[model samples]
Target: MTPKEYLEIVHIINELKDTPRHCVTKNNRIESVAEHSWRIAMMALLLEDTFSDVDIDKVMRMCVIHDLGECFTGDIPVFLKTDDDRRQEAKLLDEFLDTLPEQLSHNMRALYQEMEACQSREAKIFKALDKLEAVIQHNEAPISSWEEHEYDLQRHYAFDVVAFSSWLSELREEILQETEYKIQQEQ
Candidate 1:
């Protein structure tokens, strides 16, 4: 890709840094889509040792790019996101990807498809990390930021997503403990 093409792609992706997500930070600031993506990528990096049988590098790449769809549609919380929201984001993301150089676009398009399918080990791990990261972030945020439904969500969400791997399942259990502790403290 030419420098201009690379820069253009970067320019497009830069929107994610500014896009607000549903989650709030501990400091009471709204979280950005870029921040969430970076944390999930880091989660993949730190868990690489446990996933030696899987392609850690590919998993990390998926973590980073999985939310590129949100750059165009902004972030719709998983709970609030509807089928039409998914369709719109997918369409806009495809349009954005079309602007990239062929190889990069093709590779990311394939990765997104794999992520959606969650059949591959790399895809499964990336998907688990994405879910786990949000749960983890919810624990970090003040209890006051949570909606009534979020109490149940934080406790129960992502258990199924992480169940594909024993290690990830254990991690989800740990988050469940944190959620219980947070709720008890709130009471």
Candidate 2:
């Protein structure tokens, strides 16, 4: 790749560090999109044993690039994204991918597409972990960090995660119970 092209990729990737996760929390300290991606990648690696059939490398790649579009679109919380928002983000992502070297861009696009498809085993597992990680982060945050509406939103996400992966059912239940306890405690 030309030096200018390489620099462009670096510049865009760096933007992820500045993109904050949109989830509400009482802690008032939000995680960057880069941090969230890193955690999701680590979760894929650390949970490899639980999903013996998955390709860990592919899962890791999906985890990292799944939110790369947010660097351009900003982190639009899933609950608030409209069809137009998704189309815009997809367009931005396509443009961003064009800036990379051919093979890398192709591979990244494929991984991102697989994650979006959510049909393959790896995609399903990654999706489940993605939602699970968000709830885990929310649970770890200080009590009352979330607004009243966020509780129901989080529960919806947690239940969806359970539906995606039966292996995560126990963890999903624990997160819901803990979240409920925290809500009650705050009252």
Candidate 3:
């Protein structure tokens, strides 16, 4: 890779590392997007029972590289991302993937495309796990830490829960219930 490209990659990784996530954990730690992706991939593996028809490997791959485009676009909180912004973000993702080796780019692009469609069982399940994890993290955090994610959930993500499997959807609903309980407990 050229020095410029190498620097671009490095810069991207560093920015992701520094990006703060909306939810906090039981340990009072904020999760980064990178960590969130890793965790969700594991969630897919462990919860494969919920996604019978989908390829687990592909689902995992999709989850793993799903947010890589965010390395360039920065972390757009789920709530603040407008429909136009999401379309632009998708374009940005494609452009960045094109920078990779052909095979790698092709695979990542396919994975991202699958994620976007969310038509497959795996895609739906993956989306559910992704949001569920965030809600879980937010629930575990102190009450004061719930603004960006909660706002996003109410504004943009309110109807997204039904897009996933029943299991995943239930998990998401449970997360919200848990978060509310936690907030009440904290108060």
User: Clash pairs of candidate 3?
Assistant: 79-152
- The list of candidate 3 runs beyond 4 A from truth reads 1-14, 148-164
Q: 1 or 2: which has the higher TM-score?
A: 1
Candidate 1: global Cα-lDDT?
Answer: 0.91
lDDT of 3 at 97: 73
Q: What value does the lDDT take at residue 137 in candidate 2? A: 82
Model 1, residue pairs in steric clash: none
Candidate 1 contains a number of clashing pairs equal to: 0
Could you tell me which residue pairs clash in candidate 2?
25-145, 26-145
Measured by lDDT, the strongest candidate is 1
Show where candidate 1 strays beyond 4 Å: none
**Candidates ranked by TM-score:** 1, 2, 3
Candidate No. with top TM-score: 1
For candidate 3, what is the lDDT? 0.70
lDDT of 1 by residue, 1-187 (tens): 9899888889889999999999999997999999999999998899778888888889989989999988789999989999999999999998988888898889999999999998999998998889889989999999899999998899889888888788889989999999999999988
Better of 1 and 2 by lDDT: 1
For all candidates in order, the CA lDDT equals 0.91, 0.81, 0.70
Candidate no. 2 TM-score: 0.91
lDDT tens per residue, model 2, 91-130 = 9999988878899988888888788888998887788878
